[model samples]
Target: MRNLLVLGLALLLAGPASATEAEAWQALREGRAVLLLRHATAPGTGDPANFQLGDCRTQRNLNQAGREQAQRWGQLLRRQGIEHPRLLSSRWCRAQDTASAMGLGAVEPAPVLDSFFVQPRQGAERTRQLIEQINAQPRGVPLVLVSHQVNITALTGIFPASGEGLVLALPLSQPARVLGRIAPP
Candidate 1:
């Protein structure tokens, strides 16, 4: 059974490594890579038991430090001259608020990008769907996903703290590969 599981995991990672990663500022300047970011720093870890999908007030939210980090990251992006890039977020409140604080304009909720903390039922399927979405996006305009640590880690094997971001190059017809990371600047 363990062998079978290991094989399965191996196959999962074998997907085409086609993304080109770059530093946050560099990616913004390049204007092409997709940004997979763990939501801005929150006070605690994962959402609380009472956390509700619809109400952010009920959840452990971004503290001043987290909010400031998000804002600074956004400013960095803007300074790089990327006025607008497609922004998507996990439905979690922390993720949503993180995107908002970045001053990046309206953020679309993507359930597929939700955290896999509680044993996400269809992890592989969800990741594949998100990858397809990223690939389908038009070239030149950056794609950004504000989500949770688990989600980002599961997808890229790169564990990130809140406010950390990964720039990925996903060219249509090619596979997506990890390029580089966007650490707090």
Candidate 2:
């Protein structure tokens, strides 16, 4: 009986951390936060030397499992009450495909969301530009930005896995605060 009670107490203690994902989803659904999602698995690091922004064949596109993972993210968002988020994506094929696979509404290409992997010097400038853009936007609806891991890390200071999302409270006057992260379900 004592062991049972201890186990129950432990489970209770672990509840809040586990509940953060749900809470993050709720925050996003309410338009009180923004979601920055790293593009789903592309099965490779950075694009190939021959990569071209407009051609999926030339870029490291999403593999089969990655595609399914992206779809699952979409379903999770829908289940969490974010039916129509303002979706934005990097111009790269992988980012664009991930955003489209989310089944969210039309995705607008945001150049600032593009990967800075090749041009590391652009990271700081691009991060600043992205923050400015988000600050200028009216936060009346949920916003999801599908971008590369480098871009996401630059903005949030969290190196996210592919298909992972970081929920952030956007403060116009300062850097965004990361509320929580939601991994692919």
List RMSD in Å for every model shown: 11.3, 1.8
Worst 10 residues of 2 by lDDT: 170-179
lDDT of 1 by residue, 1-185 (tens): 99999998887776433233225346645655677888887887767788778988778788888889989878977886766877889998888888888897889989988877766766667777877776676677766789887777667877887798877766522234667776865
C-alpha lDDT (0 to 100) for residue 70 of candidate 2: 91
On TM-score, the candidate that comes out on top is 2
TM-score of each: 0.78, 0.92
Q: What lDDT is obtained when candidate 2 is compared to the true structure?
A: 0.86
Clashes of each: 10, 0
Off by over 4 Å in 1: 1-31, 172-176
RMSD of 2: 1.8
Worst 10 residues of 1 by lDDT: 15-24
Deviating ranges (above 4 Å) for candidate 2: 1-4, 172-175
